[model samples]
Target: MTIRRLPQQVADAIAAGEVVERPASALKELIENALDAGSGRLGIEVRGAGRTLIRVVDDGAGIPAEELELAFQRHATSKVRSLADLEAISSLGFRGEALASLAAVADVECRSRGRRIRLLAGEVVESAAAVPVPGTVLEVRDLFANTPARLRFLKSDATELAACLKVVQAYSLLYPEVRFEYTNEGRVGLRTLGRGDATAAAAAVLGTAVAAELLPVEGEGIRGLTSQPRLHRGSRDSLLLAVNRRPIASRALGYAVEECYLGQLERGRYPIAVLELTVPPGELDVNVHPAKREVRFRDERVVFGRLQRAIRAALNGSQPYRMAEALSSAGSAWRTPQVHSAPAFAGLESVVAEAFPAAPGAEGPLRPLGQVQDAYLVAESGEGIVLVDQHAAHERVLYNRFLAQLRAGAGASQALLLPETVELEPAQTAAASDHRDWLAALGFELEEFGPQTVKLRAAPLATPAARAREALSELLQTLAHSLPQAALANAAASLACHSAVRFGDRLEPVEQRRLLEELEQAEESITCPHGRPTRLLLDWSQLKRHFRRNY
Candidate 1:
């Protein structure tokens, strides 16, 4: 093949593919332009999942009449003037490729300042005077019409709509001061009040119930919303981070938030957070991605430290967490208890020493009023009532304490009356020998009796002797497939599980109160080591709904 220069149209199409993959990509570029134009009110409307029409209206500075046609030309930007400007790029959309790329594949109509520019395949079909608005009303129709291959790659309407709304919702958080209205299929999907209130914006997007549980995070160069550890999602989709008003995806950025919640959120569960960071223009780079959704920072360590401290500080004095009760069982009979007519809580000495930083029930926030099925503890809280899972809650309390001990030193061990000899399969025996040090750290005193047998001499602290053999055997089996750190954690969780009191165990009123009190003291008492929630909060409204007490 001979070396040859690609035609301009072919080159433009290739460049367009990088910037405009779908309706959502085009929407993102336009939104960035609106924000950069100093738009205070952004209205976005879409139909057919943005394939038919993607319109964006912003109440910002309109483009000058003379510059209307040039705006669609490649690399023509008012954002940067010199080499120094490019190095310190601040605006969200700067490469000047968005409008050109969009026009390459779609029918674009741009009307601003009494001028009109109609484009198709990156060509100017018409340029004339027209009625103008105060800001920009840029509409893109027949998206990917000429680019049939790109159209084939798009997902269904529902999926694409969700992706587009995700981008809009992210901006809504970054700029709570800017009111936004999103309409899809001739109906309003999301609208946010531009009052600079992140909490209010959260309610609009995440619902009022979740917003009520969110805490305000503030720090140097950042402020946003973060939920309690108990209120978490199965995935990190709910976590949003924006740098300088640009929604970005950086594993390190999300990790910083997760690190602060290490002890609170168990494995596989992620917290919901909206962190907006503002760095000096020179310290951050947003040009790495064509979509402007990923950024690089000069000081990631500084950002990580600041964000972690901000979240922890925000959590200070925020009265612990209580799980929200759901209608899980079909017919679990319960009563609507009166609210807040008694003492909040009474203190108690934790039976398990050094189990938690604060005594769980010391403040008597939720008084243990009674029990249900000898397994669930019913409590009278300040708001309404609380349902505590006796077994799962106890597991959480012990798990955190046990994990902390294992990290501090070799865990405290309780000696057994007589050593129990356990027989393992060949694979399990090999795994046990490989993880022998880890087993010891988990407070297991074991010796290989044979190629397929081992003796369990002592159980980890808090684990009863009766279940010691079972716990050790489970640990060895887990060791076969787990990484070093994960295997240790699994072993600790196994020990905690075997030691926790059973669900059917009968508890006297005094014992119930004691358990509730200790729960309040654990570092993060939301979920057990195995990720099972310990308590369920039945707020006043739920009680009213069931009692038919609606006014």
Candidate 2:
């Protein structure tokens, strides 16, 4: 076959693939254009998860009547002029491919300054006079309609809508002065005051309670709101980053923020941060990615170090993280304990024996010696010494038991002495409502208390009161922002992780022995549900070699 150039329609469709990967991506591009057009107030409406409709109305400079048609042409943008201008591009959008991209894959209509233009798959379908509007009113319908393969790849409506809402939330925080009202299926998902206060915007985006606990960050070139060490989430979704008011996703930046929280948060947990950095445009490169959601800095090391120290300084100036606060935050019972001596060895041995009423052959091979740093359980075995991760072992046991209960449809639920109320984020609220029945199967009895709030009357058997609350919160967060296809297993694992004995929990001799027996009975005891090892066995030979006792 001879070499040939692709048709214009085909080329435009291919180009649109990069910019409009999903409903969320399209929304992001539209928002950036509106922001660049000097919009102070924006209204976003979505239906059918942005597949059927996505209407963005902005109170910005509207396109001229004659230029409305030109705006839909490929490579048409007002943000940049020449190649030299790309080096100092301060606007969020410069490529000018958003309109053309939308017109390629979706039916796009734009009404500005009494002129309306419509396109179907990059072809001009309609151009006529319309009602005058204050700013640009752009509507994208039937997204991916022309691309059947792309439409087939979209996720569930709940998942897609959540992604769209997340994009809006990020922008709301990135530009607090821009008032935003977001509606999904006629229900208001978010509304920000946009008074130019980051904390106030945070209150509107991330719940008022969370906003109230955020600490002010004042770095040399970094500023925003960050959560106290006690306030954290199961995922890094809450870590928002913006350089010069342009929101970009950077795992390195996220790590820089989290490094400052080293030894401050538990494993598998991250803090809520909204960091905005002031970097000169000349030192930043935003044209690397087609979507402009990624960028490169001249010196990532300098930025990383500066961000880390600034966050550290902000954290240091605040009161040190309190042990009680950390414990109380997770619903664990971490209070002053009454001092007591260890029970008699014989009594504990008898209790352990009774608890594990199995055949003599089923007895655990390891013998509990004591604990280390009130964390690890040290035990003696025929070969040598074994150090058991008490938490991991307990997690393994609980996960198996929970999975069995779920499969058997007989999950044991314990009634709480006092009902607890939990207020969730917008996405979590939607997730809880969507997966209410699944949560019930996981031994949670929740009632709708109010908007974004739930009343918990019961939890999984043996789960502590506060711990159950924490588990529910984490589960909802995971369900909302994580792998929905594998949610059931993840839910069980989350429950197990929360209900298991904490690392710092001091277990009595009998308790340790009983745990060991149960672990032995578990079908899989080598690793916990999350794949962490439960025990580390140091054989006699290895120990002797380390001690220079080869003989």
Candidate 3:
């Protein structure tokens, strides 16, 4: 067959395949267009998961009446006049194929009031159109209508709607000054008025729970906040990336974020973070993909170095917030609280009862030595006196029990008689929708109300109601960008910790006895879930050496 030019409609449809994967892709394109057009406020409305109808309204400088027809024409763009301009391209939507491709498979109506001309331009181009408006109003109906195969692959309405919100949220974080509002299925979802600070914007979108743990990051010309190492979830779902005010999913950046948290967090745990880098347009390539998700930096090392340093700074600056509580009563009678708080027991009966509850097949009964200090319970065995960290042992026992329950699929759920409704930013709502099943498995039943709200029906009864709500919000926010299974597990562990007894919580004699008994029956009562040592052992010889008695 002779080589001939492909038909325009065929070519446009083919191009659409690259940029328009689903309703969310089209929404992303339109959002970028709006941002490039200098919109400060944008509103999105979707019906039938953006398949039947999708509309984006922006208060940006609109297109001219005369150029309205040309806007949808293939390869026509105001972003570039020559091929050389590609090297220094800075605009978000520059390819000019977005509208043309969208028009091929859907009924697209674009109305624009030119930046120079205030009047609306009305025209029924090859795609679709009705009356025009003052600014830019793009309405796409019957998406993939022309292409039955593409429509066949479309997901459920809820899923697609969530995807669209995710796209919008990505842009929202990049452009802190741009206010965004989203409505889906006749319900108001997310409404974020532009705030100058990205952290403030993230809090508005991700929720205060996640925002609270985020340490402010600033260093090496890169600035952002990273979640504390202890708060790490199991995945990268919480990582958000932006380059010069544009959200791009660069793998290099993702690695950089992970590298920054190395050694600070446990092996399987990953931190939640939003990293924004400012590089010269000439030093980066934003036109790497049709979807514009990836970018190539001229100096990847610099980018990586900056990212690592910034995160390290943030983590080092902020420490976990601990609540003040009353000390043990025994400590008050001592000359100093520190001395009495040391690992020592007052009574041999208490020590023997707490540390060595009759071991199976033991030859003889064990005797207890007096407390080493207030911290450790010292017991006399044939070998020597064994010192035990009571607090660490209890933590290990609790952690093991929780892990066993989780592994056995017997994790308990305590239902709230009254359901709690949380108002989420668009991104968080999307994130929640994506992980609804995971959350359910962890004993949370949640339903999406709109683009910005979730209805939480049931939660674990043992968990505090307020902490549950906060944990859910934070987990969703952190996992918005990257949702890996490991991240989910870490998040679940955090939730468990919130409900578990703290280190300093005063235990009654009966409570302490019960806890120790339970610990004796638990497997792996030596380390916490996060790998922190649960139990510490010190012998009499070591103690005597510290006091110069052995010497």
Candidate 4:
């Protein structure tokens, strides 16, 4: 077969396919164009998730009537005039493919006034017989109508709308000086006024709940913030990133964000963040991908390091809820003791004594705080209060025990009274099967029953039967992902939480005292596994201030 040129319309439609994946993508391109045009106020209205109609009105420097047609031509751009301009790309939509691609697959009607023309003179001009306005007004309709395959790939209206909102939120952070309004199906969805502060703009887009949880992130050169540990969500979709005012996604940056909060958050949870990095345009490569999602920095490691520091600083500065204090308060007959001096182990001794008072030369440090609030332990002595997170402590204890048992080949496992069977997804079953030896060493006996089921014959005797099943399943999942040994420590902590007595659970004074004694014996009793302080020291000065007696 002889090679021949493709039809112009077919070629154009194919080009559109590259840049326009869905209605949201189209909206993103238009918004970028408006922003590049120095739009101070943007209004967006969508119908049918931008499939039936999408319109964007911007009050900016308008294009001349003659240049309006040129705007829809491929490679025609006002943003660049020479090859050197590529090195310092300052505009958001410099490629000039957006309007051409959009017009190729949909009906695009645009009207604009020239800088020399009066507003009244250019108010009623027509383009393809479409109505005109003073500033730029772009109307896109019947998107992907000519390409049915594209329509098939599009998600539902609600999903597409969510994608559109995400795009708007990202850009909103980059240009806080521009007021933005979005309307879907004739109902107002979001409105962000020009605030000139990125955090304030983010709050307008992401809502106050997320905004409140976010800690301001500012590095020496880069500026941004990451969300607190408790505010982490299931997906990394909440990351809003902009490089020199251009909204783009970088996998390396995403990984850097995850690495920053590696120890702070649990498995499968991602922190929400909006990061703005300002580097000289010449030091970055923006033309790496067709859609321009990925970017390459001159000093990739430097960028990653900066991101890590910013996120870490933000997390470190934020206040975390003290779970151990809550547990101690819930326990009956527990009192916070005062510290008169700063001894080497004053605080630890006080914590142990309060948690577990000595009975005239008690043996082996009062049996170590076992479990308080069903998750932590309280031990008190003369120095202060020692609040221990049972889960973290148990994790450390059990990890060493499990490792020793594995090496000794004499690990003990207690037979279950009744065999327990757990059903998992095929992937989970595969993950569990791969880590059978590790499970055995951890004191879990398991055998595959069917395609997606496992039968458990025994579990660690130290762990409660009620919590064994959940712990086994969690361990299997963790092992499947090849998580580090540190993850097992976290799992152990979770297990301790499940088996320990919980807050609001009525406990006799003796039981509470016994739990406190156990905490005193445990090492690292100052905090829980998650790094929350186990005990809070309210000083005499603070107490006086609370009662207004200091004056």
- Residue 513 in candidate 1 has what lDDT? 89
* Residues 345-387 of candidate 4: C-alpha lDDT, one tens digit per residue: 4453443332321221222243333445565455543333344
After best superposition, candidate 1 residue 76: deviation in angstroms?
A: 1.4
Worst 10 residues of 3 by lDDT: 328-337
What would the per-residue lDDT of candidate 2 be over residues 164-275, giving only the tens digit for each residue? 9988999998899999999999998889998999988887887665676678988879999887765767777778899999888898999899867753555687788889
Ranking by TM-score: 1, 4, 2, 3
The deviation in Å at residue 361 for candidate 1 is 4.0
lDDT of 3 by residue, 270-360 (tens): 6667778888888999889888888898989888888887876776565432211112121111011132222443444433332322221
Query: What's the alpha carbon RMSD for model 2?
Result: 22.3
Question: lDDT tens string, model 1, 1-551?
Answer: 99999988889989999999989899999998999999999999999899999999999898999998899999988898887886777788888899999999999999888898999999999989898788999999999999898899999998898888887887887888899999998898889999988888887776665677679988998889888665677678888888877778889989888867765666777777888888888898777877777788998999988888898898765764533322111220111112221122211121111112222443248788898888899888666566778998788777776677767666678788999999998778888878666667668898778878888888787787888898888767777767764665666676677788887889998989888888877755766776666766655654564555778
Pairs with steric clashes in candidate 2: 331-466
- Candidate 4, residue 219: the lDDT equals 91
Would you list the C-alpha lDDT of every candidate in the order shown? Answer: 0.78, 0.81, 0.66, 0.66
Candidates in descending lDDT order: 2, 1, 4, 3
TM-score for predicted model 2 compared with the true structure: 0.61
| lDDT comparing candidate 1 with the true structure | 0.78
